[model samples]
Structure formats: structure tokens, C-alpha cells
Target: MNRRELREQIFMLLFRVEFNQKDDMPEQCTLFLEDGDTEISEKDAAYIRSKYEKIAEKLPEIDKLINETAIGWDTQRMGKVELTIIRLAVYEIRFDETVPTGVAINEAVELAKKFGQEGSSGFVNGILAKFA
Candidate 1:
């Protein structure tokens, strides 16, 4: 899988964090990789799991940043899809130096377009622009 595909998988896994109990995430992540339609190689699967774990570790900090940057928007009140996209983008922007900030923001916008509501792209762009 390409980097974009990996990112989408990571995002999907991260999205589950909102709904699943923390204890179940490990099992859920494993199932997600094993039960997918497209077969991900072991190497790529490891990469996805590692990134997801890192992002999950930093979620409190990530949500804090989102709480601070998003004017008039509480992290808990934000749409789940938008929040997940923002969390992934924030991780890329702040923790993953390999990903350029612009690319991270652009990719978040794309993810928002795919999984978020109609205005989600613009909303995500607006929030992420604070970091830019």
C-alpha cells in the first residue's frame, strides 16, 4: 500500500478510538487489519499499527491542541469524523517530521472530504490552518 493508503487505514483505526473502549482497541486494530478487503502486507500492517499506537498515545495532547486552536469549538463537541481527521493531521504535523505540514493539512482535507460531512473539508481546513 502507498502512504496515502496507509494513512487512510490509520485514520480508520483511529476513528474507532472514539467508539470502542480503550481495552478493546488492541483486539480491534488486529481485526481491522485481518478483515480488510484489500490485503496489507505485514510490513505495511506493522507501520499502520505503530502509527496508530503513537497517535493513540498522544490523543490527550492532540485533543488539548484542538481545544486550544479551534475557536468556539470544544473537542468533545466536534463531529467524530472531523475530530479524527484533525487528530491524524495534528500527529503528522507535530510528531511525524517525515510528513510536510502542508501535505498533512492537504491529506486531512482529503480525508475529511471522503469521510466527513459536506462542510467538513472547509471546517477541517479552517482548524488546521491555525497550526499553519
Candidate 2:
């Protein structure tokens, strides 16, 4: 799979982590890859697994930035899915400098559009734009 597809997979994996709250990341990451029958290359799966694993390692800092930058919304009040999107987006913006801020924002917006409520994309776009 390409970058966009891989990112989508990462998003889903990260979202599952939030739901499951199991901390064994290597096992969880492997489970995610194994469960998906999509034709992602092993290399792409490895990249996503590493990124997602790193994101989990720094979740406290990631959530702190997300809560601070989320304007009027508390991270607690946000839907679990939206919160996960913001966390992943903020993690990308802060930790992965290789990804342009705009690309990170756009990717988050797209994920919101696909998985969030009607206005969630706009909301996510606005918050991530602040980082850019």
C-alpha cells in the first residue's frame, strides 16, 4: 500500500489501542497487521507499526498538546474517535518533522471525513491548522 493507505491503517490501529487499552504494543501491532487482509507490503506494515508504536510511547505528551491546542474542547469531552485522530495528527506534527504540517492537517481532515461526524472534518482542520 501507499503512504495514504498505510496512514489509514495506522489510524485504525491507533483507534483500536484506545478502545482496548492493552499495553503490549508488539503483540497488538502484529495483531492489527495480521487481521487486515489488505495488500499492504511488509515494508509498509513495518513502517506503520513502528510509527504507531512510537506514538503510543509518547501518548501523554501527545494528548497534552492536543488538549492545549484544541481550543474550547477538552480532550475528555471529545468523542473517542475524534480524540484519537487529533492525537495521531498532533503526534505527526510534533514528532514527525518529515511530514509537512499541511500534509498532516490534510491527512487528519481526510480521516475525519471518512470516520467522523458531519462537521468533524472542519473542526479537525481548524485545530490542526493552528499548528501550521
Candidate 3:
């Protein structure tokens, strides 16, 4: 898979965290890879898992940043899909040096357009742009 495809997979995997318990995520992640609609290379799967875990590990910090940046729109009140996209973008912006801030924001906007409500992309771009 290409970088965008792998990021999509990582987004999908990270999306699962909002629904499943911590204890169930290991199995869920495995099932997500094994039962996905498209086949990904083992290396790609490993990359997705690692990036997902890294983002998961930093969720508290991520949310804190969002909470501070977004005024009244605390994470608990944000739409789940929007929050997930924001989390992924925040990780790329703050933790992953390889991703330029502009690319991260753009990708998050793309993900929001794909998976979120009609206005979600605008909301995502507004929030992420503050970081850039």
C-alpha cells in the first residue's frame, strides 16, 4: 500500500479505540488487519499498528492540546470521527517528525471529508490549522 493507504488503515485502526476496551484492542487490532477488506503487506500492517499504538499512547496529551486549543469543544463533546481524525493529525504534527504540519493538517482534512459529516472537514481544518 502507498503512504496514504497505510495512513487510512492507521486511521481505521485508531478509530476502533473509541469503541473497544483497552483489554480488547490487541485482539481487535489483529482482527482489523486480518479481516480488512483490502490486503496490506506485513510491513504495512506493522507500520499501521506501531503508529496506532504511538497515537494511542499519547491520546491524553493529544486531547489536552485539543481541549486547550478548541475552547469549549472538549474532546468529550467533539464528534467521534472528528476527534479521531484530530488525534491522528495531532500525533503526526507533534510526535512524528517526518510529517510536515501542513501535510498532517491536509490529510486530516481529507480523512474528515471521507468519514465525517458535511461540515466535519471544515471543523477539522480549523482546529488543525491552529497547530500549524
Span of ten consecutive residues with least summed lDDT in model 3: 65-74
TM-score of each: 0.98, 0.92, 0.97
> Taking the tens digit of each residue's C-alpha lDDT, what string does model 3 give over 73-101?
88999999999999999999999999999
Report how far off residue 41 is in candidate 3 (Å): 0.9
Name the Cα RMSD for model 2: 1.4
User: lDDT per prediction?
Assistant: 0.95, 0.84, 0.92
Model 2 local distance difference test score: 0.84
Model 1 C-alpha lDDT per residue in residues 22-85, reported as the tens digit of each score: 9999999999999977799999999999999999999999999999999999788999999999
Clashing pairs in 1: none
Judged by whole-model lDDT over C-alpha atoms, candidate 1 comes out at 0.95
Give the top-scoring candidate (lDDT). 1
